[model samples]
Target: MALQILLQLIVTGLAWGSVYALIALGFVLIFKATDIFNFAQPELMMLGAYLSFTLITALKLPFLPAFLVTLVLMTVISSLLEMMVIRPLVGEPVLAVIMVTLGLANVIRGMTGLIWGYEELQFPKPFSAQPIMLFGAAINQAEIFTILATALLLVVFFIFFKYSRAGLSMRATAEDTSTAFLMGINVKRVFTASWAIASVVATIAGVLLATFTYLEPIMGHAGLKALPALILGGMDSVVGAILGGLIIGVAENLAGFYLEQYLGGGINEITAYVIVLIVMMVRPYGLFGTKEIERV
Candidate 1:
């Protein structure tokens, strides 16, 4: 019985970890391209899920078409956000940009509540409502699909970043914005594209999360939880984000299972933060982040 419970917890942790990875990826992608830590990413993701839910449940649209439409709309919304809020902050201090994003997150959360109401809404599952059994443990089809889909999306993004022309432009911009501009790269356009891509990624993550949990105005706050993954994986590494998420997920599950008996309630929520604190104390740059040198 003990072994079976442990196995089940591991599987559940992995599935939830994948969702965290997807959300963390959005934060890493936008930060990599623009050097701005977007606190609004979680809210953006929540908005995406809500929008998708509205399309499927309220408008009575089919899943396939609704998914595509939601992606496109998220892309547009992200781009517009970049233009209106982020673009003007070019060359501004990092603190200023971060503060702006914090405000943006609050604005998004309030706006979503105002528009959609504070009620918890149910989201339709993209897959059939069946549980898949593996090695004496069972997980819902939606959980399995969400994990697989997030992995596939990460692969696609990896390929795009490595092989595509636009991907090269994005990298170049990240390397040195002024130098990229000198080489005729449209820095503004790249920033817009980064934000758009981040939004789309967040939207997908949100949809997946809504599959397992209730959807509400507060759903976006989950993005804040992803900060631990970002810190663990390094802010600039997308691959690190995925790995960090998995580590955090597994660790949380294990703690909940093993330590809950001693620690009582809510240990799961604090597990990631505790891990981050330890990691920072040991290695501030994270697992994959480049070491920084400071000069007096």
Candidate 2:
């Protein structure tokens, strides 16, 4: 019985963690390309989910078509945002740019609330609700899908970054914008592509998350939960983000199950943050992050 409970928690946690990984990847991708920590990522995820909900429920589109359309729409929106809102701030102070991102987050949140209302809505499930038994643990089909989707995207992105021309250009730009431009890479286009890719990842994560949880303007708060993962994996490391997400997810589930009984019911809610705090103290750069030193 004890073993079964542990297995269940592990499986469930992985699913949740995979969603975190996807969202955190969005953070890493944009930062890698533009050196900007986008505080609006979560809100972007929320917007994507809301857009999906509208497409599926109101527009009566099929799941695959709706999903594809949502990706396209998100890509376009992110690119446009990069061009209009972020481009002007290119030479501005980092703090000022960050403030803009926070402002952008609020703008997205407010617009979502005005359009969708504050009432919680049920997101249409793309997969069956049936529980799949895996080694005596019952996992929701949607959860399984989330895991698979994350894996698939990871593989796709790995190939993209490893071999594709655009991917190589983005990588070069990430390494050094000045050098990349000297090499004839279009730095501006790379920035736009980075934002577009991040938006697509956010959309997938948001849609997967809403399948299991209630959809609301506040749903983007879940992105905050991924912050631990981002910090744990290293703010700038893609692989670190994935592993950090899984670790946080499993830790949260384990904490909820065993520690919650002794502490309180909300232990899981704060578990990731607590762990991140500890990690920050021990290794400020994160487990997989590279430490930088400045000679001043």
Candidate 3:
């Protein structure tokens, strides 16, 4: 019985962790390309969810159509954001760029509230709620879908980053912006692509999460929770992001299951941060993060 409960928690954790991983990937991708830590990422995730909800509920579009449309719209929106807001800040101090992102986050959050309202809204479920037994643990179809969708998306990302011409250009640019431009790589296009891709990834995560529960502006907080995963995996490593998310997810669930009873509520909420703190004390740069040295 104990083992069954543990398995159940692990499976559920992986599902939520996948969402965190996707969110973390968005953060890492843009940071790698532009060295800009986008504070608006969570709000972008929130915006995706709200836009998806509006498409389905207001426009009466089916789930598949709504999902694709949301992706297209977010890609354009993200590109515009990069061009209009971030492009002007080029060559500015990193602190200035970061502050702009913080301001952008508030603007996105406020706009979402004004448009979607603060009330929780029901999201159409893409999968049935019926629980199926997996290795003696019951798992919901929605959880299964979340995990599978994450896997598929990761595969697609791998292919894109590994084989696509644009992907190679982005990689080259990320490694050295000046050299990339000297080599004739279009750095400006790569920046737009990175933002668009990050937004699309965030949207997918947002829509998947909405399938599991009521959609509310507060759901963007999940992006904040993903910070530990981002830090734990190393901010620049994609594989680390995925692994860190899974670890945090499973650890939080296990902690909540076992420790919450003794500690009296909310242990799960703090578990990810606590674990990251301990890990960083030892690794400093994260388990898989690259170490950088600068000469005076």
Model 2 scores a TM of 0.98
Q: Tens digits of per-residue lDDT for model 3 on 19-133?
A: 8998999999999999999988888888898898889989999998999999999999999999999999999999999999999989998888888888999998777778989
- Model 2 residue runs over 4 Å out of place are none
**Rank order by TM-score, top first?**
2, 3, 1
For model 2, the run of ten residues with the poorest summed lDDT:
134-143
lDDT of 2 by residue, 192-291 (tens): 9999999999999999888878799998888888899999999999999999999999899999999987998999999999999999999999999989
RMSD of each: 1.3, 0.9, 1.1
Q: Per-residue alpha-carbon lDDT of model 1 for 89-160, expressed as tens digits? A: 988999999999999999999999999899998788777777777776776777777778888998898899
lDDT of each: 0.88, 0.93, 0.91
Q: Write down the worst ten-residue block by lDDT for model 1.
A: 130-139
TM-score of each: 0.96, 0.98, 0.97
What is the descending lDDT order?
2, 3, 1
